[model samples]
Every structure is written in C-alpha cells, then in structure tokens.
Target: MRVTADLDLCQGHQMCQVEAPAVFGTDPDTDQVVVLDEHPDPALRPQVDAAVKYCPAMALAVTD
Candidate 1:
C-alpha cells in the first residue's frame, strides 16, 4: 500500500503523526504533515488507514 498527504489540505492537527509516528510527522518549521514513507510495509497499512481516517482535514489518502 501507498500513502499520500496533501500538505495544502493539512491543518497540522498531527493526528497522523500521533497515530503512526514511523510513517508520519510534522515539519518543525512549517508544522505541515510530512509523509515519512509512501510505500510502507503491509503490516503497517492498518495504522496508516487509521491515520487517514482520523485526519479531520481529509488530507491523507491511501492507495493499494
């Protein structure tokens, strides 16, 4: 699976980072959502999906 985040759509809520720190984080300067990995392991897909679901701004997307 692949994950992507629209920086423009992000409100810096940090839910994704909170849910999966290994795959997501916030820029220290801009505080925008940063995708640490686009193609994560299958084992991590669920967490990624959860992050996407929890994004209030709908900035996250997953493609499998």
Candidate 2:
C-alpha cells in the first residue's frame, strides 16, 4: 500500500503519528504532518488505514 499526506490541508493534528509512528510524523520546520514512508511495509497497512480514517483534515490518502 501507499500513503499520501496533503500538507496544504493538514492541521498538524498528529493523529497519523498516533496511528502509524513508523510511517508518519510532524516536520519540525514546517510543523506539518509528513509521510515518513509513502510506501510503507504491508504489515503496516492497518495502522496506515486508521491514520487516514482518523485524519480530521481529510489530508491523507491510501492506495494499493
């Protein structure tokens, strides 16, 4: 699966980090949510899905 985060739409809520710490995080300089691993391991699909679902800004997208 693949993950994408729209910086423009993000509010830095950090929900992605909570769900998938290994695949997402906040950029210190931009203070925005960043996709640490766009193409994360298959094992991380569940957490990534949760992150996308919980994104209040609707900034995250996932695709297989």
Candidate 3:
C-alpha cells in the first residue's frame, strides 16, 4: 500500500499522528501532515487507514 498527504489540505489536527505515529507525523516547521512512511508494514495498514479516515481536512490518502 501507498500513503500520501496533501499538505495544503492538512489542518494540523494531529489525528494522523495520534493514530499512526510510525507512519505519519506533524511537521514542526510547517504544521502540516508529514508522511513518515509511504509503504508501511502490512500490520500497520489498519491504523494508517484510520488516520486517513480521521483527518478532519481529508488530507490523507491511501492506495494499493
């Protein structure tokens, strides 16, 4: 799977960070969503999907 975040669409809600710290985080300098791992472990897919779904600004995307 592949994950991506549209920085312009992020609202610094941090839900992604809270849901998948290993795969997503907040960029201190920009206050934008930062994708830590585009291709995370399969075990982490669910958490990543949760993060994507929880993003208030709908900034996160996940694809095969």
Candidate 4:
C-alpha cells in the first residue's frame, strides 16, 4: 500500500505522527505533515489506517 499527505489540506495537527510516527513526521521548517513512507510494509497498514482516520484535516490518502 502507498500513503500520501496533501500539504494543501494539512494543518500540521500532528495526529498522524502520534498515530503512526514510523510513517509520518513533521517538517520543522514548515510545521507540516510529511510522509516518511510512501509505500510501507504490510504489517504497518493498521497503524497507517489509524493515522489516516485520526487526521482531522483528512489530508492523508492511502492507495492500495
């Protein structure tokens, strides 16, 4: 699966980082959500899903 974040929609709430720090991070320069892993290991799907769900901006997208 592939994961991506829309910077335009993102407000740096950091919920994704909280939910799945392995796959998401904050850009210190911009305070925006960054996708650490575009394509993640299958085992990480659940956490990735949680991050997506918890994102208030709904800026994260998962493509399988």
Worst 10 residues of 3 by lDDT: 25-34
Candidate 4: the clashing residue pairs are none
Candidate 2 C-alpha lDDT tens digits along 1-64: 8799888899988999999999999998887898889899999999999999999999999998
Taking all chains together, each candidate's TM-score versus the true structure is 0.95, 0.94, 0.96, 0.97
Model 4 ranges with Cα > 4 A deviation: none
Q: Top model by TM-score, which number?
A: 4
The digit string of per-residue lDDT tens for model 3 on 16-54 reads: 999999999888998988898999999998999999888
**Error of model 1, residue 40, in angstroms:** 0.5
Query: What tens-digit string does per-residue lDDT give for candidate 4 at 1-64?
Result: 9999999999989999998999999999999999998998999999999999999999999999
Off by over 4 Å in 3: none
Candidate maximizing lDDT: 4
lDDT of each: 0.92, 0.92, 0.93, 0.95
lDDT of 1 by residue, 1-64 (tens): 8899998899999999988888998999998999999898889887898999999999999998
Error of 4 at 18 (Å): 0.7
Question: What C-alpha lDDT, on a 0 to 100 scale, does residue 9 get in candidate 2?
Answer: 97
